[model samples]
Target: MKHKKYQITCPYCDSPALFRPASMVHGSSVLEKGRYLYICSRWPACDSYVAAHKKGKRPMGTLANKELRHKRMLAHRALEELQQSMHMEKWAVYLWLQGHLHLNEEQAHIGLFSEQMCEQVISLCRQLIRTSTGTTA
Candidate 1:
């Protein structure tokens, strides 16, 4: 796959940033978002960050504040539950999400989603799980 470089910036402050390990960013051995994380160069003031994929420096998505990060986590959990309930493979669940959300494959990731989109993911996942399992989810 051709990896596209992400020009990540603080959503709040619009500052230049750096992509490094979360441990370095936090000044501690924090393994929350794999080993790689992006932080605003003006961090401590801007407080924006994004986690990279486990194996690469590529960001998982756009930089976010605490609120957006929480919403993304909620969406991710709901997606996981929905996938398990439907007994679907990860790629298939992502395909379903892309089609339902009117997103192209490249834009289907929860990490790239807004708060509204995250809520939509939870709602859709609930509906899908309920129908698939024939029980309220």
Candidate 2:
């Protein structure tokens, strides 16, 4: 899968910064979650690194329908398979995979099986919740 690249402006320098995939760090706890490491294209000149955040939507609010549930279940199953094949934890894999899916912060958080997987799980779960609720995530 191809990972998406993000273009961010440095808060301090305001230079055009390109973010590239770096590595993953194990989270602090089961709930704390892990993060993605992004390296600045500018490298030593810029020395910028950014981490992605995990965001999730509540299951009760907008996702209380049926269609969303189906979609979420499918995504969950796919993620589970990927995790099993990779032999890694679910949350981390979800987070890494969410980027390829173009999921927003909230959606990404729901798909997670753990804190590290929060973002991916949230994204996937929101879709599931939405499908079940007959809405969109």
Candidate 3:
């Protein structure tokens, strides 16, 4: 499918931004009315994000900023919860690896949890949890 591009400003750094068509999902359009996702060109450093729509593209001044704020809050809360859960699981796994798996000191040190790997494990856990609970993590 063809996608459009837009020039935007990074919400965090106010730098020039670009929104290229990434993908299209089946359920809903990510770039639909009242919604937009623009990524900063200087990614992995700037890490800026803007979740807003273009002028005249959506109902002027009628966008639910409050609802958007609430959704952001919920998303942040969910992320925090997931982080905590993942931390606990990581510690448990570390302990298990050290105790039950009987890894030596050097092996245990090498097997120490990396945040990136833990994040992947946490993502998997989130998927499983969502599949079972029918809720977002």
Which candidate gets the maximum TM-score versus the true structure?
A: 1
Better of 1 and 3 by lDDT: 1
The segments of candidate 2 whose C-alpha lies over 4 angstroms from its true place after superposition are 1-61, 102-106, 110-137
Better of 1 and 2 by lDDT: 1
Error of 1 at 99 (Å): 0.7
Candidate 3 TM-score versus the reference: 0.26
Which of the numbered candidates is closest to the native, going by highest lDDT? 1
21-129: candidate 2 lDDT, tens digit per residue: 3332233545434333443445546554444443221121121113343445565666675566556697677567567566665666442323334345546545544
Q: Cα miss at 98, model 2 (Å)?
A: 3.1
Tens-digit lDDT string for candidate 3 (1-137): 34344455554466665553222111256545445445466653665444434543221111122333344445334445544655556455445435633665454432132333334444544664466557556
lDDT of 1 by residue, 1-137 (tens): 66666677777798866877688666565444458778888876777788888765788888888889899999999989988878889999999999999999999998899999999999999988877678545
User: Judged by lDDT against the true structure, how good is candidate 2?
Assistant: 0.46
